[model samples]
Target chain A: MADEAHGEGGGLSFHPMDQFEVKPLFGGYDVHWYTITNVTLWLALAILAIIGLMVLTTSKRATVPGRGQSIAELMYGFVYKMVEDVTGKDGIKYFPYIMTLFMFILCANFLGLIPMSFTTTSHIAVTAILGFGVFIAVTVLGFVKNGASFLGLFWVSSAPLPLRPVLAIIEIISYFVRPVSHSIRLAGNMMAGHAVLKVFAGFAQVAAIAPVAIIGVMAIYGLEVLVSAIQAYVFTILTCVYLKDALHPHH
Target chain B: MADNTNAAAEVAAGTQAGMPQLNVGTFDNQIFWLLVTLVVIYFVLSRVALPRIAAILAERQGTITNDIAAAEDLKAKAEAAEAAYDKALADARAEAQRIAGETKAAIQADLDVAIEKADAEIAAKAAESEKAIADIRAGAQDAVKEVAKDAAKDIVALMGGKADAKSITAAVTARMKG
Candidate 1:
C-alpha cells in the first residue's frame, strides 16, 4: 500500500510541460504581452473550428435545413431569443454581442472537456476579465440610456426616506461587487469541479485493481460533462440578466 | 544557526531534484493573452461575421416580401376574372328570360287571332242555316194552296159542266164570303 501511494504521489507530481512559460516579449514593456499555454492555443483553434462550422453549415441556405445548419441556427436563435425575452424588442440590437459571448464561452467550456486540454475559465483572472468587461459595458449602457436616472438604481425611491440611504448603500456595494461575484462564481465552480475530477481520476488510477473505483471515475466523468455544460449556460444566463438591467434601467 | 543552514541546504537539494516550480506572474500573462484573444474575436465577429449575417437576413426578408406581393397580385387577378365571369352569367340569364317572355307574347297573339277567325266562320254557318229553313217553310205553304185549288176543280168536274175560270173564281169567292 505504501509503494502504491508513493507511485500515485509521483504521478501526481508530474507536470506536462515546464519549459514554455509566459514572459515579456519585449524588455521593459508591460503592454502587448502573451502567455504560451496549451489552453490559449486550443481556445483559438476551437473558435476557428466553430466559426468555420457555422459558415459551412449555412452556406447552402437550403429550405430544409440540414443537421449542421439546424444546430447552428438553433444556437443563433437561442441567443437572439434570449436577448429578446430578457430585454424586450429593443434588445435585438445587442444580439451580436450576446451571441458572440455565448458562443465563445460555450466553445471554451466544451473544448476543456477534451483529453489533454486546459480550461482557461478555471482561472479567476480569465473569468474576472470577462466579467469586468460585461460590467463596464452594462454600466456604460445604463448611464448612456438613462442618464442621471441611472443612479436611481442604487436608491430605492419607493422606500421611506430613512431607509433609502441604507438601501442605497447596500445596493451600491452589491453593484460594485457584481463583477467580482460573477467571476468568482464561475471560476470557483469550474476549478472545484475539475480539481475533484482530477483527484477522483488519480484515485481511480491508483485503485485500478478495484473495479468499483473505475466505475466511480466513469460516473464522475459523466457528471463533470454535465457540470461543464451547466456552468457555461449559467454564465451566459447571468450575462443576459446583466444586459437586461442595462437595456432597461427601471426596477 | 547551524540547523537553519542545514535546512536551507536540504531545501536547495530538493529544489534541484526536480520539484517543478510554476513561473511567477504567469497569471497576469494569461490574462493579457486572453484579453488579446477576446479583442480579436470581437473584431472578427463585429466586422466580418455579423455584417454577413445581417445581409443574409435582409435578403431573406426581401425575398419573402416579393413572394407575398406576387401572390397578392395573382389573387387579385383571379378575383377580377371570377367577377367578370359572374357578370357574364347574370347577363346571359337576363337575356334568356327576355327571349322567353317575347316568345310567350307572340304565341298568345297568334292564339287570339285564330280564335277570332273561328268565331267568324261559326257565325256565317249559322246565318246560312237559318235562310235555308225559311225557304223550306215558304215552299210548304205554296204547296198547300195548290192542293186546295185542285180539290175545288175536281168538285166542279163532278157536276158535269165545263169549268171556266170566271165560274170557278166566283164559286171560290162565294164560299170564301160565306
Candidate 2:
C-alpha cells in the first residue's frame, strides 16, 4: 500500500502515512460503527495478549514467581509503586485503573511493532478516550473529594490578588488543554515513529540506497521499541500526577 | 507512457481515500472497542490479576514477618539460656567457695583445740617439776642438820669431856628444828 500510494511513474516512491490508515478487515470501504476493521482486530489481539500475560500466566500465584508470573508481578509492582509514590498511600485504591491503562497502551503499542502490525496507540480516537477518561475521572474525583472547593485548583492564592483572575483564566485553559496535549503527545510520538520506519522501509526499494535504508530502518526500529515502552510509562505517570492533583489539590 | 499515466491516475485514486485515520466513521468503531477492551481489562486487573499479585506480596511479607518474629523468639530463648547458665555457674562457684571456707574453718578449729590441750599438759608437767625441786631442797637441809649434831658429839668425846646422849640428842634436835 505504501508503494502503491507513493509510486507514480516507473520510479521508486513511498507514502509513509499510508501505514496509519485504518481499513476494514473485510472487503468494504465503509467502516460502520459495528464494522470489524483492522483496528478492531488489533484491539482484540491486545486484549487477548493482556489476558494471556496477566491473568492466565499469573493464576498460579506462586510466592516465588516463574518467568511469566514475574513479568506480571513486576508490571503490577511498577504501576502500584508509581501511583503510591506520585499520589501517596491514599492513591493505592486507584491502582487498578492506572495499571489497566498502562497495560492496555503498553500492550497495544508493543503489538503494533510487529512487521505488519497496526499501531493502535497512534490513533487519536484511542488515545483521546484514554486522555479524556483521565480528565473526567480526576475532575469528578476532585469535586467529590474536595466539594466545591475543588475550584481552588484554579485559584492561586499565593499570587497577588489583582492578578488572581488572570491566573485563574490561564489555569482553566491549561486544565482543559491537558487531555488534548496528553492524547496528542502519545498519538503523535507513536505515529511519527512508525511513519519514519515506513519511509525508511520504502527507501529500501531503491537499488543504490538499499543498504543505507535498511540500516536506517533497523536503527529507527530499535528506537521505536524504546519509545513505545516509554510513552506508556509517561502516560501512566501523568495519569498518576493528575490523580495526585485531584487527591491533594492544595499542593 | 500510457501505462504510466494510468498508474498515476490509480495513485490519485488511492490518495482520495484521504487518511483513513481521520475518517470520522471509524471513530465509533475504535471508541467502542476501546471502551469494551478497557472495561474488560479493568475488571481483569482489579478482580483477577491485581488481587493475585497483591496476595503474593502480602504472603511474602507475612512470611518474612513471621520469620523475623520466630528469629527474635529464638534469640530471646538463647539469651535466657545464657543467663541461666551464667547464674548456675556463679552459684556453683559460690557453693565451692563456701565449701572451701567451711573446710578451712573446721581445720583451724581442730588445730586450736589440739594446741589448747598441749598447752594444758605442758603447764601441768611444769608445776609437778617445781614441787619435786622444793621437796628435794627440804630433805637435803634436814639431812645436813642431822650430820652436824653427830659430828659435834664425836668431837666432844675425843676431847675427853663427859657427853650425855639424851642432852646431845635434845640439843641437836632443837637446832635442826630451828
Best by DockQ: 2
Q: What is the lDDT of residue A204 in candidate 2?
A: 91
Q: Give stretches of model 1 more than 4 Å off.
A: A1-35, A61-65, A88-93, A140-148, A206-226, A247-250, B1-24, B79-178
User: For model 2, how does the per-residue alpha-carbon lDDT over B93-142 read when each residue is reduced to its tens digit?
Assistant: 99999999999999999989999998888888878877887888788777
How far out, in Å, is residue A192 in model 1? Answer: 3.0
In angstroms, the error of model 2 at A91 is 2.6
lDDT of 1 by residue, A147-194 (tens): 988888888888999999999999999999999998888777766665
Q: Model 2 over residues A1-251: C-alpha lDDT tens digits?
A: 44465546257566676667767788656667777888888988998999999998888877778999989888988998999999999999999999999999999999999989888999999999999999999999999999988898899999999999999999999999999999999999999899889888888998899999999999999999999999999999999999998998873
Report the error of model 1 at residue A43, Å: 2.2
| Cα RMSD to the true fold for all candidates | 11.2, 9.9
> What's the fnat for candidate 1, on a 0 to 1 scale?
0.23
Segments in model 2 whose C-alpha atoms lie over 4 Å from true places: A1-10, B1-16, B82-178
TM, chain A, every candidate: 0.84, 0.94
**iRMS values in order, in angstroms?**
7.8, 3.8
